[model samples]
Target chain A: MTDRPTIQRILTGISGFDDIAVGGLPASRSTLVSGTTGSGKTLFALEFLARGISGFDQPGVFITFDERPGDLRVNARSLGFDIARWEAEGRWMFVDASLEAGEQTPTVGTYDLGALTARIAHAVRQIGARRVSLDSLGSVFTRFADQDLVRRELYRLAGMLDSLEITSVITTERDADYNGVTRQGVEEFVFDNVVILRHVIRGERRHRTVEIVKFRGATHRTGEWLFTIDPEDGLVVIPVAFLAPRDRASSERVSTGNTELDAMVGGGVFRDAVVLLIGSHGGGKTLAALQFADAAYRAGERCLFHAFDETRGQLGRNAAGWGLDLDVMEASGLLRVAATYSEVASVEDHFLRIRRDIADFAPARLVIDGISALERRATPRTLLDFVIALGGVVREREITTLFTSAPTARGTSPIMEIAGITDVTLVLRHIEGPGTVRRAIAVMQTRGSAHDRAIREVAIDDTGMHVGDPYPGILRLLPDAPVPPSDREE
Target chain B: MEDQPPAALTPMATYAFRMYVAGRSRRSQAAEENLRALCDFYLPGCHEIEIVDATEQPALAEEERILATPIVIRKSPLPGYRVIGDLSDRSRAAFLLGLPDSGRPSPEGQRL
Candidate 1:
């Protein structure tokens, strides 16, 4: 048996792209990036060059066919890329192929793109560029009426780039989101690698995803992965499955803020555990979350508390009503409260914002008070993915996190789909007593440890939550459903 | 190569042409020949042609934003026109270049 030479790869420096690409794009080869209009194809192409220059110290050439170099410079500046500076430093070059206004070039007979190829080669040699990005081949197809000639010339151009040992990205446009690979059928065939960017409207919100169709003589993760275009950071592919597998389990316990509830959960939850608190409205779920945050603050650990259903003032007032001072904690620099309505942004945006907050604050403990409010804006599957992706983030850092959710009217919770991922599950329900209503709490499941199986009565007073003795003979704990009558009265 | 025209030809208005091509390839040579033939029969002794090899002077090609090879630019006159590819069809190329047909030879007698 003969051993084949392994193909070398060059890192694209795009966040999360390298992870999904396994290593990066196959080195010294051209990859075609195809997308529909408004699918961020230009942004992707620009970032590939920008990141190569900024992150890897590798010079690049950007051959623009759709947008002018000045427009691209201004557009790239929004993403914090100093393309003009890079150009001045001899690290970046632009081959302006975009048509000028009022410019007309009438074709008379046979012609080839030899001049363009010469100009690209000149720029590449001038800058000693290792990377090249040609934005939107669709413009070239539109400019040249002869498709066969354009395709043949582009294939030759790719070969020229290959001989120069330059890794290149050529972007093309797609007519539809899920149609064929590109507008011209020959584009994909001309390149060795193909990547598709999709911007689809799901549930009335725009969702962007990237899928690697093929990488010749190489391996990559298949299927569509979610990505977001940030105004400040450019393109960021969300690699949900790329999270490092965490096997570092902490046996150390941490309080859930209230000591009595801690005792019910067998000396508190694991230090790196992800605890989910499920309850109905006015069932003291937020109170438990607030207590969790307060405990982390008192323990001298920074905590990030995000509330989706309430404003900051509302949260402060609610905390004050429970005799907990949120302002003092905020001033102490150990607690940061971020409050926003769930409808303000899409679920993916929310995830990005929270991820940014975590990165900035480096909080040891994180709490999301009302995740169910986000459920209204996203589908059930998206909601579950959000939690899983969020879990991937916090678990990698071993940050103790808590999420509170309200059961749906259907009596099933979206978080139930991710039950195995959670280390601790806490359920709170409202009990209908004789002419009165009382609240009950239970330690449903504590992974790797034994916990109290009894259903106990829970009370929220000015001093906050207090866990009392077990409520008698309550077999069911469905929040919205009618609770069965207790067999034995307390 | 033609020398400077006489002072009387200046009254006819000089026609300046800049042709961009990729090196000394066959298509470029053909384009240069066809352009000289058209200029000789029409503006005869009054036109100036400059052939630029894009491979040797890429900066000039970049300035012109040239893509396809063997393109001719009518740089003189108030309105400039650009025609890409080898000028194989002289009549169509002349029409696109806005050349006056008053002094043109008959189609049957012309052999280009």
Candidate 2:
């Protein structure tokens, strides 16, 4: 790559957003903020202005339509912004054109935004503002019957702000039926940069995502990066860089917390490899993962156990019964256990929480006790995208991760899907014969090693686990044993 | 212009009008002229007219919620009124200003 002059950026101060933007926004330019109602477009704009004023020493003006400046101040306060103080201190200016539609408003002739432009110019001058947000342009532009006139006015407004050297964020309402970023499609044409906010509903949950549709002079990460509006933090962007690729591969390996099981996978799992342990409910998947946790802790490495199906306390006690001493590891700060139900938060929020934990803990070994429970929280496609994102995050950090999931009767589940992307796969199942039941584990696939193929009877006890030799003879009495008769016919 | 407040005008005019106009636009200039003529004929010496150039003073326009150009507003007389466009039609302009039908001159051509 050749050296290129870097485009100057104004840091938005929103968490994780700068990473996806490769920095903040391009300075002294307009960025279009488009989304349907309740998708947090207004909040995004407010947060940008608030952050600019408070954090970057950049004063701003908020020109609004349909919402009064007083009400906006109140709403912003509820979101933990003290815009009222900023306005009082003359660091901010709010120009409201929301009530301009009624008869009380001054009526003017066709294609005249002279008054609006003058008011904005006066506000920018009053505060010497570096940032400006008009939330929104749709309500204002909808007053026009002429599309061409609206387009011209929008271009003129952008140019006006550009001439003042103020970087502005102009919000435009997006309709559910409309295809373009803005309601009129004029915003995208006028502004050099556009950012789209989407609220995707899965079941009863709304997953909020932000995507930069276009950035004129910069190369941006092209994907929908996740974001959530915190009542206190305002807008938090989950950067795509968390999943960006690593420069070089590491050949290090870590134990699975069991000597016999480690040997079965040819001297334990490789560093940075994602291992999937597929099993039915209560098929010793958690126990196998705990063994890996124990090994990691014993190696003096940090471990993070993110549990979806069980409580952290329950996991601690369960590991204690196996003599793994997870409680002691946690007490020593060698291990951290966090548990949350998937239904409590949207899939994106849950990912953010997990990402936060990973960032704070910086664990070398990570284990998600159950991914199937997370899958239950979202649609198949949503879950797939989330898992892919999660996989990317861990893979980039070169963190060895173990995820457990229950297999369907057809051997299909999130585990099966993740197994393809992961480096190793371990399938665990219950073997039933007449009136007896036994647990068996088979190494389906393992990267960087010659893994065992034979299914083995895995025994778990207080001392740990024992991997018994090949149980091929016992498969005759089990259902779907050794590929069954259908496989032979096919 | 300020010294001569239009001959035959009374000091206690009941009706008050403010016409908002952009700079030298043909439509705005027509609206301003039409508004002055309408007031001169209808209210005669009983009304007051104030012409505000929106281009020169946009902050006032924004404060008044001006969306378009060449708009006439009747600020007094209890409920305010707004008229969009050039205000060239006499009857429509009369209706917007809440003028009585008899406010117009007869065929004999009465002057203010």
TM-score of chain A of each: 0.88, 0.76
Candidate 2 global lDDT: 0.75
What is the lDDT of every predicted structure here?
A: 0.85, 0.75
Candidate 1 DockQ category?
Answer: medium
TM-score of 1: 0.87
> How well does candidate 1 reproduce the true complex, by DockQ?
0.76
For A1-490, candidate 1 gives per-residue lDDT tens digits of 1112588889998877886787789899999999999998999889999999989999999999999999999999998898999999999999999988866589888889989999999999999999999987899998988999998899899999999999999999998988776889767776779999999987677789899998888888888878888877678776553244566778889999999989988998888888988888999998999999999988999999999978999899999999999999999999999999999998888888998999999999999988888877876666766777788788778788999988853345455654546789998978887688999998878998999999999988998999999888745874444322242111
Chain A superposition TM-score, candidate 1: 0.88
Point out the worst 10-residue segment of candidate 2 chain A by lDDT.
Answer: A476-485
Best by lDDT: 1
Provide the TM-score for each candidate, comma-separated. 0.87, 0.74
